[model samples]
Structures are given as structure tokens and as C-alpha cells.
Target: MIKFGLLWHKISLYASLLWHKISFCGIKFGLKLNISLLWKIWDYCNQATFNEVVYHQRTISSFLKVVFKEVDSNFAKLGTTNNSWFDYLILRRIGVETRAAPPPSMIEVHWWPPVGPWMKVNTDGSALGAPGSIAAGRVYRDHRGWVRGCFHFKRGLGFAFETELLAVIYVITIAHHKDWRHLWLEADLAYVVRLLNSHSLDIPWRFLASWKWTLRLLQDLRLQVSHIYREGNNVADLMVNRDCSEGWWPYALDEIKHAVALDMSTYSIIRIKY
Candidate 1:
């Protein structure tokens, strides 16, 4: 009886979620994105949740401020708007009437595919030791989760940023070579994504020439870059841990094959946090 009651409760909750989804239209991220936000609203009901509301509002504002400020700083550094900086800002005016956003919540996440004509690349880079042996890896997949390609490279005596930045540059190079003009680049490093989106000149001087070339190539292609937490980037992370000195895999490696299959089946990996 208890289990039956719990099932019914979930059904009712989902029904409400569906209704709200149909009614709300602020963010176009779709049902999956809003699910956790709505779930967070009622996860722990009481004064504590209200307190969290205040905390999260401040956190979101600060995060947005920092990201925008960084971009603005980059714009100043470049002193030009013609460069590709991924200008993205959807400003919504807050009227006297408003909706309350809920605090954060744990959610299931998975490898999401790009729409048709757009290929995706998930990448990661790590150093054995800071300023030590560093390597990077990337996996290209289509909307059907078809393994388009897998590549990685090793470098001796370099900082982690070298691998991370190189990972981005290499993926762009691949896209151009393959004529995949529509590209979606995903990386585990938020900072790396920010650098690309900001078009910052703060990169290492050694890569400045290569970075400029990539930026120019970006103009000729439709490209997007995003950040995913390390967990969701399992395929690329696994690629980095292997000896890729042999170079491009004819197919997905055995270890990461299961993950690629799960993505093809639209499987979600659950994440729980305190």
C-alpha cells in the first residue's frame, strides 16, 4: 500500500509538472532542463528552502556578472567587435510581476546530441603533474551517437592549459579538415569554454598565432562551445587516460564503447549531491 501511494504521488507530481511546462515559456531549454528546476522547488519544503532561495539568487547574479565581466574585459583587450566572441545574451526585463526561481537540485544528465547538420565533440585534457606530461583527447559524434572519430595527442613538459587549449584548437582543425562547418564543441573545463566564448587574448603567447588562426577559421564555420561537468564527458575522459601515441582510433575504444552505446540509447547517468 505504501509503495502504491508513493507511485500515485509521483504521477500527480509529474502531471503538475506537465501543466506548468505547457504554461511557462521563459527559457527554451525544453522539458528536460526545467524538470530539475521544478523538482528543486519542493524537494525540501520549509524555511530552509526559502533561505536557499535567497542564497541561489545571489549566486546566479554573481556568476552571470563574472562571466559577462570577463567577456567585457576580453572585448576591451581585443578592442574590436568583429572577432567571434559568441555574443549571447537574452535580456529579460523584470516587471512588477515575476516568477520565483527555485534553488538548485540534483539531476540526471547524459550526453545530448546536436541537431541535424551539427556534429558534437566532447573533449578533456589533464596533466600527470602541473608543468609535467600533459595530454588531451576528443570524441566526435553525431545526433545518432555514431562515433565519427576519436583523437588525442601527448606533449612533454607543458602546463594543463596547454592540453586544454590545444584540445579546443585541435577539434576546430578537425572540423575544418572534415568540412564539418556546423560544430558543437564541449569540454569539461568551464574556463576553456569561457576563453573561447570570450575570445580572450589571455592565452599563452606561444599559442597566440594558432589561436588567431582558429578564430579566423571559426568565422567561416558555424561553431558553438559549451562546458559539461567531468562526469558527463566519460568518453573523452577515458580517451585521455589511454596511450594515444598510436593516434586516431579506427573505432571507439573498448573501454568507452559501453558509454557510447548508452548515449545512443539516450541513457541518463544519475547525479546526487548534498
Candidate 2:
């Protein structure tokens, strides 16, 4: 009896979701929705079990294809201006808003150089597998775009996040050794950026030591850690991809000068189309 009740509840929920989609698309596109068609769709959604959303998606899509073909009002063009009936249901299933695409300017990403005398250090970490060989890389560049320091260190047996934290700790150590007080650190990992910014003590036990060391280093240095798009962080990404032998020390900027120059010239004006 309990299983039967649960199945009925899910079927009702699916029917409700399907109805909402049809109504929303009809109102938004100024289309005359066929009530008979809407009922058929709801019935189909109701018959599909809770875990069969993907499997039944094809049937729903095929029904929409026939309905769209009969309407013959360029409802396909309405897709660009507003969400289609099928898309509306899919978006609701995935918990996304049904709205028109934002302007291109809204999605544009820019890579700005560090301001004033502050040094910008971009770091990234790569791993072949979760528990496989890991590597952390960082490229330190000044306001004038000169590479002050960079390195790719081999860290054996760790996950991606572990290597990212390792890179952060290692770079902070370099800054401390150089006694650089003003610095800006950038990484492609948003979670790591948030951890650094919040100075959160609640972290995995394995990274507790590195986390404490990072906090200690931050005490003496004026540092700003931020998250940047991977596109803006090609230099550090290159370092992450490189192979490093045992006891590999940081390389000077001159070694990766060619790649750095290319990234600098192309960093500005990242255009993203919706």
C-alpha cells in the first residue's frame, strides 16, 4: 500500500509539471494550446515511472514535433525569443528558469592585469586520476606582466582539490620567502578561492596542515585571492600540464616566455555567445 501511494504521488507531480510547462509556453508564445494535446501529454508523463524521465523524454519530444509541424507558425523561431514547450518542461525538471537569453555583454569575461605594484600569482593543479599522481603549478607575474617566479611541482597520490590546496600553500611560501607583502593570488577553482577568502577552519583532515600553514602566511602578507576563468589562467594551466621530475625547482619566467607572451596578447576581450 505504501509503495502504491508513493507511485501515485510521483505520477501526480509529473502531471503537474507537464501542465505547467504547456501553459507557460502557450502564454509566452501567444499560441492557442490544444487542450486535447495537453491532456495526452499529461497522461503519458503520468504513466512513466519516477526514474524514467530520460527514457520517456523521447516520446514527449516526438509528440511535440508533430504538434509543432501542424501549428506552422514558426514556433521554432519562438525558441530563440522564448522557451519552447518541450524545453520549458525540461528546464523545470532541472530547476532552471524559463527565460530569454541574456545579452552578450552579460556573459563577457575579461582578464585584467594586476593593478599598481601588486603581484598576481595564478595557480592551477592537475591529476591523472583522483588518487593518482598530482601536480600543482603557479605563475607569479608583476603589474608590468613580468614573470617573477613559476614552478610545477610533482605531488604524488592525491585528488584534484588536494593539489589545488597544495599549490596555494606552496605559492604562499614563496611569497613569504621573498618577503612580498602586497600580492594578488588567482586560481581557477572557485571552492579553493572561497576557502582562502573565508579562512574557514572546517576542512578535510588531510589538508589541515597545509590550511594552517596558509593562514599563518596570510598573517604577515597583504594578499587577495580570487577566482578566474580557465581562459584567463593559461600560463598556470600550462605549468599544471608539464611533467616534473623529482626535486624539480621553480623555473624563471624566461623559460616560459613564449607562452606567456601569447597569453598576454590574447587575454583581453573574451567574447562568449549564448
Candidate 3:
């Protein structure tokens, strides 16, 4: 009988050192192998090494899988017409073609009046402490840059998203009251826009009744919904939570007056996307 005692790592040596992949076989014996050989075969993160792990999925099998995957990726990137036997095997198993990254984009945005006979409504919400006192507002304007009417409401404690949804419902209710069927609605909150376009079940239970009523009123109107960045929607931001819920057009707030003038003149603001 061969002297197994002569072998440095008896457990790994018993595998007869699979000549084609000795390194791969060595990692399979990590649990009982010598510490020096185990160190070379497997890697451990800070959390896994000193035992600070919140992720409990780390194991010898997973480490070997990760190592082989990274090797497969590097060989795939080479994209050489004539690949070696190992490279060919890896590419065939991965079964994917390399692709180039898409280029970045830069866009310029500005508030534009609704075309033809349509009216424009911009709405926004604010909460000083997010979960603290909440308020919301909406402004109405026409193609001629004339303010028909506007309302700002300060309500009981609520989250900002709730305030945003409430603001949309408020605008819808008022639009029905005023019999404004042809309207273009805009908001700074993308969530509000998405909510309007999705099923009512997507909202919180507290807002379900209001959401249903809003959607019902919307069915009777020619409402066009869209999203605007806060920069372009600053007019609504400035008017929110005034002394009273009722506001009229006469250049009362100087900042709002300037913003309306800028939008009317078709001045643009550059929006950068990284």
C-alpha cells in the first residue's frame, strides 16, 4: 500500500489530483484540507472572515462558483475568432454575446402652455418634516398666460406622498366643478403621474376612496397627464400653503410672477442626466 502519510494534504491527495483541474478539485476539499492550501483555493470577505456576516449564504461551493464565473467572463470579453478549448467551453456554457453601453443623454425642459383650446393645471405638495404637517396646492392657466383661478390647502398631519395624491384629487374635483373638460394636468411628483395611469389598488387604503372618485371624474374629462421636474414646477411650489386655500392672479408673489413670465416667453432650463 502507498504511504498516505507521506502526502501533504491526505484528503485532497486521495482524489488522485484530477490532472486536468487540480486547482478546482483542491477547493472541493477546503473544509478538511490544510489551512495553507485552503487559503489559496478560497476567498473570504471582511464580514465572512472575521465572522461579522449578516449574509449567511457564503460557503465553499459558492466561492468556487464565483471564481469560475469571473474566469468565464474574462475569456468571453476577449472575443477572439479562434478560441482555446477552455475559452470555447466557457463561451458555449455562458451563451451570451457582448454588447456596448448606451450613450448618455442631455435634455432641455420648460413649461409650455397647452395647445389649442386646452387649459393647463400644475399641482404640488410639501411636508416640512415629511411625516409632519402636510400641505398642497394647484394653479390653473390658459394658453393666453391668464390665470383662471388657483387653490392652496394646508391640512392635518400626513406623509408627503399622501399630500401629492391629495393634490391631484383636489385638482380633479375642481376641474369637474368648473366644467373644464379639456385640460392638461402636470405634477412634479412622478409617483402621482404613475398612480393616475395605474390601477387604484396601487395606492394606500386611506386614499382608495379619493383615488376612485378622482378616476371617476377623470373619465368624463379630456385629461392629459405628464411629469415635470420641480424646477419647471416651481410656480406651484411657491403658491403652496398660502394664508388661505384660495389664490387669484395679480402677481401677488414676485417669484411666481417671474416664473409665469419665463414659461410664457418659452425660456428653457437645461436638465442634465448622468
Candidate 4:
């Protein structure tokens, strides 16, 4: 009985070494193993070393089954050849071939509607090469998500942040001129949102003119300014990249209409399972 127990310990140790080698190989090629399973295997090996259980072919087979069951089937297929014992074991259990699960798709959150029946404007700006050439854009949508107006400008030379803040300034001025009292302004840039939200006057000297004017317009209106993710600001994004310097308003431009339609459709929620 003592000799059999000693031989079982050696076999378990050898099996552990093999698992370590195979797991390492899989990891080297970007395969992620089930960590909980790895821990269980480690614990079982440690217990086998300390326990007085006698060796048996059934016990060894059962141990292999437990370890293999924990492995990712797809990765297992990648690591072993058709003739490999692991492959043979998998084939016997599942029959035919079992493909790995597809990778999880990314979760995309799109434009959320504004609160209540208030007009909302989504604004964005782009600098072709940071400071090379600048363009600013804004898209207006009423409570029902109808395109009220849209505008774009070829503002000659400026930084990206400058263009972003300037775009908000233009939108607010337009809103004020039209006496659109209840307004919501949304932009993708965090700094631009912060400046408007805090009503800050401390801005770059060049932007001071537009900044002060925007504040004056804000004084009389029921206004709200917030930041949105870039994905949700697609219509404004399209306007900035368009060839026209102005008048994409009423969404008459076919390309702009198509983009807006697509953006509106993507507002639905998507759920992804791994």
C-alpha cells in the first residue's frame, strides 16, 4: 500500500507539470484560461500530495476529466493536434467539432433625448491637423427629435479646443437671436462643457470676445449645457466634416439627412453577451 501511494504521488506531480507547460503555451499565444479552474486544479494537486488515498486508474482518469472540463474548448482545439490525447478525449465527449464562442461585441450608447419639451443642440468642431484649418458645426433638434436647423463654418486658423468652444458660442448666439428660450446645449469636448456649465470667464485671450458675448446671451435664457460621448454627437460630427461652409439647416442636404437618419436609428440600446 505504501509503494502504491508513493507511485501515485509521482504520477500526480508529473500530471501537474504537464498542465503547467500546456497552460503556459496557451497564454503565450494570448489564450486566457479560466482562473477559478486553475486554482481548483492547484488545490486538488496539493491535496493529492498530502492525502493517503491509494493510486488507481479510475482516480487518475477522473482527475484528468476535471482539469480538461475547466479548459476553454476553443483554445484546447487550437493547442492540440487531432491525434493528441486531449483532442481524442474532447471528441469522444462532445462528438464532431465544437467551435469556440465568438468575441463579445462592444457596448455602444448613443444619443439620449433631452428632458421635457425643450430644444436641444448637439455641437462639435474639428481641426484638420490640430491647428492647420478649422471647422465648427451644430445640429438643432426639438423635443420630438426633429431637425430644427444645422450650421457649419470655415473658421480659418485655430486650435481644436478653441474651435470646440467657438462652436458652442455660435449655437448659443443663434439660439438667442431666434429667442429660443428653453435650450439644451450638448458637446463632446469636456473642457468646452465645463466652461459653459461653470459660466467661467477665465479662457484664452483670443476666445474672450466670443466667450463674453456667449455669457451675455446666456443671462436671459433657460439654458442647460452638458457633455456627451463622441458617438452620440454623430450628426454634429458629420456637419463639421462636410464640404459646405454653411446652410446644412432644415437638413435639406441629402448626405446630411442620411447621416441624421442613421444617427437617430442608432439611439436604440444594444446588449452584448460573452
Residues 86-142 of candidate 3 have per-residue lDDT tens digits of 434433443423232234576888888887578799999988785888888778888
lDDT digits (tens) for residues 180-254 of candidate 2: 789899998987898888998877798798789889989999989888888777778877776555333445544
Q: Write the per-residue lDDT of candidate 1 for residues 1-274, one digit (tens) a residue.
A: 1233343354344334333423433244335434644464344233233443223343433433443343334333322221112211121211111123343468787888889889999999988887888988889998778889998788888888789998888889888988998999998787788888888878889999999998988897898888887778899988888864638775677878988887777678777653
Q: Candidate 2: where is the Cα deviation over 4 Å?
A: 1-110, 244-255, 266-274
lDDT of each: 0.68, 0.68, 0.65, 0.69
Q: For every model shown, what is its TM-score relative to the native structure?
A: 0.60, 0.60, 0.59, 0.58
Error of 1 at 111 (Å): 0.7
Q: Please tell me which model should have the higher TM-score, number 1 or number 3.
A: 1
TM-score ranking, best first = 2, 1, 3, 4
Q: Assess candidate 2 and give its lDDT.
A: 0.68
Residue-by-residue lDDT tens digits, candidate 4, 88-148: 4443553334333346676665776665668899999988785769898888888667788
- Higher-TM-score candidate of 2 and 3: 2
TM-score of 1: 0.60
lDDT of 1: 0.68
Best by TM-score, which number? Answer: 2
lDDT of 4 at 262: 69
RMSD of every prediction? 18.1, 11.3, 12.6, 12.2
